[model samples]
Target: MKLSPSVSIEQSETGLEFINVASAKCDAKIFLQGGQITEFIPKNNKPLIWVSKNETFQEGVSIRGGIPICWPWFGNHQNPNWPAHGFARTSLWQADEVHENDEQITISLKLPMKQVNTTYWPHQSALKVEFILTDTLQVRLTTTNLSNAAFSYTQALHTYFPTSDIKNTTVDGLQGAQYIEFGEGPFTQSEHVSFERETDMVYTQAAVQQHIHTPDGIINVSRENSSSCVLWNPWIEKSKRLSNFADDEYLGMVCLEAANVLEDKVTLEPKQSHTLITTISWA
Candidate 1:
């Protein structure tokens, strides 16, 4: 995958390169000193998550959704052009702008109507994604509905956080909120609580932020305008199937995603917009 230097390269003040692979479409690798990936990797199969290492993260992370502008439908419901998660994550997006400060690097990408065919989404829309990597990581995705009618869609940051143990971890955020547990069967909202194994849940109307208590330190997730939160750790058996993820790697990570799904879909009128913001800080 040869990305033209003109198309997909940005740098920090210290000269650390952020490789943006537009063809991989949803892939990004952040390289720091000694070429470490201090983030996440996109598995070829899922384009989400990565193998977790015990040390500090080596890769930056993958952005799973665009401002993933899904229209008319979401999830898997027999749509040809628009797949289960939406096309924004898989479609080619142009690098629009880049900036660097003393402490962080920010890169912006744009997906427009001219950039993509609006067959599944028959409207002109502008999707902008900004990746701000400072001491903490802040990812913001904003979608503007440029079309005439109102549009509704679901979105997620789908973050893969590095940790030490799945069993010894607890996410502190949705303590009193409601969540849809996917552990046994269909979606059902229950009281938000701690985890043990294979905990796949969607907390409804959750707080804008959450905290993961790992042995090393706490990773706080702060967000805005996103009412749903997802907590998942895919145990062992399921981990082997992923190419980019190592088996038993589940022991070193937990996923706490910021989402707008099902009951909390966003609707925008012509030229109106909505923003999904997520900030990951270590303490």
Candidate 2:
């Protein structure tokens, strides 16, 4: 492990790397390999994120929890054999900037196109992720097109939140939105969402803010420039098949992702850019 005043490089027993942070209103741990945040705990509040105690933390492997960045594309690729969630989650990122102020601390990391595999994304683009560590953690991910032509893709800030119990927790503020899961009906959300079994719903034209009513309390998840969000919990059997995840871990974790999918996918012209932002706080 290597240490700085507010940040450090920590390696798991398996030799996976992580950038541990404590510069601002919260403590965080981000993996340098993926620039993926695996942990964040704001002062005076309970831990909002959760990871498996049995996580393997192997290098070049995606971490099991916190906020995973799904870029360029999400889910299964058109080629079928391609990676499930694009390359950003497995690529190494450079820490381009780090700043601290009385109000907050900010860390910026950029993934240069040269470091990415052309087979996954043949376009010239620059991807950057900025994290504002404060009492309420804020994150912004930006993508800039460097080529003359246009490129389009869907993405998500696939964030996982901790809960006392999945069945007892409900996600409100999605009422009236439209959701689809497993080729099911384009169901209209007429009430708050609660879990009974496995869920993998993707909601489009969603509201900017939502509330997670966990046994601990209500957590506010707010988004900007986002029209879609995903609600997922791979309850029971599926949990046993996940990597670096415990079989019963689904009981304590739920993903409320800020996303751009289907109609909300982004298309950027030459030199154009798009940013998706989200903020979280406990009430």
Candidate 3:
């Protein structure tokens, strides 16, 4: 694959090597230590895959369609159609900038103004995603509407986390939260968060961050300007159809989506921008 113009590489204090794909609009981790992926991110756009592997240092949390960023709409959490989880995750992005130092590297990608979005989303806007990494990881998404008419949309950062066993894992920070059980599609559940057969609940008005505790370590998810969280694990059946997911892979990962949904649709006036920042730090 061709590297973007703004790409750069550097060494970190921990002896970790960083590879920033500024042009391809993504990040790559070519080196790590102790057989662990020191950094977690995506690679080139063809497969639109995220994560990297250096021998046993695999950072990939395989969930098939990569980390789908549902935008404009986060599927019909109330209905059944709307294409699983919306479409922003599949769209190709253009690199805008890249910067690197001994400790970290940052890469920015944008969805430029185009004639295509007029059909469904009739607003002129740009979606920008920034990848900021040290030995740790953070991703920030900014949406700017340049059209005269104001527009509203729901957004999500669907993260697939790696684990030894989902049964052994638990997500903290969602205690005593209420959610909508998506079967009749939007049925509300005002109960404590716990394990179920096929967990598909949308936790509304969540705390700005949460933690996914695995046997290995804790993956902390912190957000800014977001109000909703979705904790998902497709279990056995759903993992079969997805090519990028190994059989029964659902046992090893859970999706903790930092989202804006339902009554919380974000609106951007002309020349205005809305930003969603997510930081994934491990310990």
Kindly state the number of residue pairs that clash in model 2: 0
Model 2 C-alpha lDDT per residue in residues 218-255, reported as the tens digit of each score: 99998888899999999998998898888888999899
lDDT string for model 1 (118-211, tens) is 5667777787777665455577878898888988877776677766667777777776666666534344444434556677787777888787
Worst 10 residues of 1 by lDDT: 57-66
**TM-score of the candidate numbered 2?**
0.96
Worst 10 contiguous positions by lDDT, candidate 3? 30-39
For residues 36-133, could you state the per-residue lDDT of candidate 3 as single tens digits?
Answer: 12235433212112231211222322124234566667766444643455545544445566666655667666655472345556777887777675
Q: C-alpha displacement of 187 in model 2, angstroms?
A: 1.5
Candidate 2: which stretches are off by over 4 Å?
1-4
lDDT of 1 at 225: 87
Our model 2 lands, by Cα RMSD against the true structure, at: 1.9
Superposed model 1: Cα runs more than 4 Å off: 1-82, 115-117, 183-193
Q: Highest TM-score, which number?
A: 2
Q: Candidate 3: which pairs clash?
A: 4-23, 41-51, 42-50
RMSD of 3: 8.4
**C-alpha RMSD (angstroms) for model 1:** 8.5
lDDT of 1: 0.60
